[model samples]
Structure formats: C-alpha cells, structure tokens
Target: MPRMKVLLISLAFVAIIGSLGAALYFMMKDSGDKPKSSHMARALAFRVGFSILLFVCILVAWKLGYLRPTGIPLQG
Candidate 1:
C-alpha cells in the first residue's frame, strides 16, 4: 500500500469523525431558539459531504492505480 494513500485515507477518516463530533457539539450547545440555519445541521452536512468525497476519492485513486483491494476474493 502507498504511504500517501494511506495517509490521505486516515486523514479523511479523521475529518469525517471530527465533523460528526462538531455536529454533536453544536446540537448540545444550541438553545433551540436559534434561526433556521442551524450550525448542527451545517456540521452534519459537512460530515456527509466529506464522507461522499472520501468515497469518490478512494474510487478515483483505485481507478488511477493508486489503490488495490486486498480482501478475500469472492467465490465465482
């Protein structure tokens, strides 16, 4: 496995977790009387975006020959 690819995947996982934590924080911190644009919602959106982006990145990297699946092969 490439070191850079590993690092990037690790970073993406961290980012996704961090975004989720932030959303939780905002959810608990907000007073519920806030405006329609909630910070918690924004954080959750960011988490979703990061997750999707990470998935796409992994796919692209695999297509570009940067990553390879190492799991057990399916029985055909």
Candidate 2:
C-alpha cells in the first residue's frame, strides 16, 4: 500500500539521519583528545528521542492499517 511505502521511506530517512549523527559524534570524539564527559550523554539522548519518535510513527501506521506485516521470504 501507499501508506506502507510512506512509512518505510520515513523510517529509512530516520535511520540515515541517526547513522550520520552517530558517525559525526564518533569522528569528532576520535579527533579530539579532550575530555568528552557530555558526549555520551548527548548521543544517548538523541538516540532515545529519535527511537521514541520512530516507535510512535510505527504505532500510528499500524493503527491506521498502513503497516501490516508481510511474511515474505528473504534472499540470503
């Protein structure tokens, strides 16, 4: 369904953003030898916030009948 596609696309976008954020955080941390006491906290907060948002999106999509599971076979 179109709605399913939309949800999938949105999830993919969120994943990409999360990955980029994590990569940036790590790269910055690696390059800097200074103490990063707050770095881990910040990253954790971002991940938790974004994960909650993603969960809410999934719930909404499921409730609206936009995301039904398809038992399709996957190729190795």
Q: lDDT for every model?
A: 0.85, 0.70
Those runs of model 1 whose alpha carbons end farther than 4 Å from true positions after fitting are 35-37, 74-76
- Tens-place lDDT digits, model 1, residues 1-76: 4787788889999999998998878777746677424878898899999999999988998899878889999999
Per lDDT, the best of the predicted structures is: 1
Candidate 2, residue 49: Cα displacement in angstroms equals: 1.1
* Number of colliding residue pairs in model 1: 0
- State TM-scores per candidate: 0.83, 0.51
**Candidate 2 at residue 34, lDDT?**
44
The Cα RMSD in angstroms, rounded to one decimal, for candidate 2 relative to the true structure is: 5.7
Worst 10 residues of 2 by lDDT: 31-40
* Candidate 1, run of 10 with poorest lDDT: 28-37
52 Cα displacement, candidate 1 (Å): 0.4
For model 2, what is the alpha-carbon lDDT of residue 18? 77
